[model samples]
Target chain A: MLIPHPLLGPRDAQEFTYLGDAALLARPDGMAEGALGAFIDYVYLRDNPAGVHRELWFHEQGDRSWLVVTRNTVTHEIIDAQLARDVALARKGAVA
Target chain B: MRFSGFRVIKEALTGHKGWQPLWRNPDPKPAYDYVIVGGGGHGLATAYYLANTFRKARIAVLEKGWLGSGNIGRNTTIIRSNYGLPGNQPFYEFSMKLWEGLEQEFNFNAMVSQRGILNLIHTDAQRDAYRRRGNAMLFSGADAELLDRDRVRDMCPWLNFDNARFPIKGGLMQRRAGTARHDGVAWGYARGADRAGVDLIQNCEVTGFRIEEGRIRGVETSRGYIAAAKVGVAVAGSTSRVMEKAGLRLPIESHVLQAFVSEGLKPLIPGVITFGAGHFYVSQSDKGGLVFGGDIDGYNSYAQRGNMPVIEDVIEGGMALMPMIGRARLLRVWGGIMDMSMDGSPIIDRTPVEGLYLNAGWCYGGFKATPASGYSFAHLLATDTPHETARHFRLDRFARGHVIDEKGMGAQPNLH
Candidate 1:
């Protein structure tokens, strides 16, 4: 599988370490009233859809930035790719 | 029907007309005492155990596809009880015992061959690890033998011993562990369940669960709504998706694990053999095709297919293990979605929701654990208590800091 990185050019999937669903980035704070439960969900529960999925892939063999790749699970078609930090910042901005 | 030599002879003499269908194809009933979604090996085996052993009446197994169309038919078909963890060793050993008597109990041929399984040791540290594992297997009432390099060479001299990077040091062999026909297991269990008057409904996909007042009333399937007192989900890879419909999130990830079979050749491999330093295990089928697989695709997806990188990775392992197999032509390659749990162990316990039970997170070990998984899961559904051997497979184990991290890979599913 060729993953198009936001910074690097198209790279092979073997060059990246797969960290599951991109939703893991929005980690819940560990020191809130319901933080334990929220942290459990953040660390464990996943959508794990059969169709399109947004997942985190670390370019361990290339540039070190984590990329959030939107790809179809069934067809393995990459729809888009971007830096995961950017996606996290965008999520925060939208929330703000 | 009882299958025997006489039955075969009678059928042969009577133009082969006396044979009946292995299991009936029935439609969904409006209500049942218990409904099990997913008619794969585990589901079928669970239904069979519930009906036969627990004497449960009005049981139904609903499958979205034809039975055995899922991972039940898409595994390497190796069976062993060589785990090192206390929480895992007993459960798998129980499963190995069930596999021993499955064919006789079900009155069907599952080809439960107990030839042996040899896990090669490549280094001194690896040998020490295998020694500990072999001792653990022995302690769990399973037979194990620590074979030295000479014994391994005596068993199979064709392995790359001299020039390989990971030189063979020794191996841990379990004589009672071997391979079986993957599809035959599903067929046998389905037949057993059907013979016990349990309904086997195919092409019935469960779209949602009918939970009322914090209790599961039944399930809403593609066929229609079916009411049941209890619902047990044994879907292998689709556990998360199916449970999500009931508003529950599982601590599981779906990853694609690819399997390959080589063209039929002269019988080469004596029994199941796994490379110590690499992620390659191979066994020769009755038809002489080498069945093998390695690690998962290292991604979370529900896709039942994999890419070329893992294929190359697996082939490299095979080459490193046995140079003689480098010329073998590949027959076919396929993938199955694995319910990789965070701890790399399975979860077979009751969910937080009332009247709903779960049996999933088998990872690459599901095929070997089919019989015990079903038996223990049936115990849970019938008695509302975890089976004695499966007491450690609790959903809240991770929350309680009791993760059964068998591989010691932390919470990484891919590494496990």
Candidate 2:
């Protein structure tokens, strides 16, 4: 599988380390109220769908950037890839 | 008819004309006392134990496809009770006891061979861990032995013991653990369930659940609606998808695990040998082909295939342990989906939805847990109570902060 990195072009999947669902990026504050429940869902639960999935992959062997890759889990076809920092900043901006 | 040497002789004399189909292709009934989804090994075992052991009646096993088409027929077929944790050791030990008497109880030849297994130790710290695990196995009423390097060498001398980086120090051996015929176990249980008047319905896919208020009344299927008082789901790979039909979300993720076999050779591997330093485990099949597998692909996928990286990683581990294996040509490779749970353990308890029970999250260990999983799930579905050995497999364990982290990898489904 070739992961199309935003900066590195199409890199082999072996170079990236998989951290599972992109939902891990929206980590809840451990010090807040109802934080335990939030963290439980954030850590344990996942929408493990059989179709398209947005997941986090670390380019550990190459650029060392976290990329949010939108790919179909069934066919292993990558649709889009971008730096996770940009996606996180955009999500926060949209929320604000 | 029951299988025996006398029967074999009789059939041989009769030109093999007296043999019949292993199970009947029964049509779905309008209603049953209990309905089991997923006619794989666990499902058929559940139905088998429900009628024969629990003495329940009117049970129907609905299958999306034919029986033994899932992970039941896709695993490496190793059965052992070498667990260390309290939450898992007792349960697996009970399953090992069940495996001891399975063939005679079901009257089918599953080739239940207790040929022993060896987990090679490559470091001093790993040796201590195996010692603790061996003691735990003994405490759980299972046999275990700590063999030194010389003993391990006597058992299998072809190992790369003088390697510079990771040498074989010793091994943990379980004398009474080995492999069984994966497909035979499924067929035996299906035959026993069918003969005991349980309907074995095939090509019947469960589409939705007929829940009245908060309780399940029956399941809507591709065939038709079949009313059932209680429902038990034993679909490991499709656990999340099937439970979602009942308006439920599980703390489970599906990942694909691959297995491989090489060209047939002479008797090479004695029993099962696992490389403690890596994720590789191997054994030679009865047909002389070397069967082996390693870690699951570290991602969420429903595709029943894995990528090249995991394959390379597994073969590298094998080569590191035994350099002689590099000469054998790879013959076949396949993948089976795993319902990896949060804590690396399984869940065999009742769901919050009334009249619904769950038996999933077996991950890579589903094949070994088939008999006891069936027995425990049947006990729960029959008496509405958790089995003694399986009480810790609750769905709320993760929420209650009582997760059974067997591998000490906290809350990571992929790592487990």
Which one is best on TM-score?
Answer: 2
Backbone clashes in model 1, listed as residue pairs: none
How big is the positional error of residue B215 in model 1, measured in Å on the Cα after superposition?
0.6
Task: For residues A20-90, write the lDDT of model 1, one tens digit per residue.
Answer: 88888888878889998887777766778888999999999988889999998878898899999899999
Docking class of 1: medium
Measured by DockQ, the strongest candidate is: 2
TM-score of each: 0.98, 0.99
Question: When superposed on Cα atoms, how far off is each prediction in RMSD?
Answer: 1.2, 1.0
CA error at residue A15 for candidate 2, angstroms: 0.5
lDDT string for model 1 (B1-416, tens) is 78999999999999999888887788888999999999999999999999999999999999998998899999999999999999999999999999999999998999999989999988899989889999999999999999999999999999987644788888999999999999999999999999999999999999999888899999999999999999999998998889999998888888999999999989889999998468898999999999988989888767799999999989999998888889999999999999999899999998878999999999889999999999999999999998999999999988777999988987778888
Superposition-based RMSD of candidate 2 using all C-alpha atoms, in angstroms = 1.0
For residues B1-416, what per-residue lDDT tens digits would candidate 2 score against the true structure?
88899999999999999999988998899999999999999999999999999999999999999998999999999999999999999999999999999999999999889989999998999999999999999999999999999999998999999888789999999989999999999999999999998999999999999989889899999999999999999999999989998877788999999999999999978899998577899999999999999999988888999988899989998998899999999999899999999999999988878999999999899988999999999999999999999999999899898988888998778888
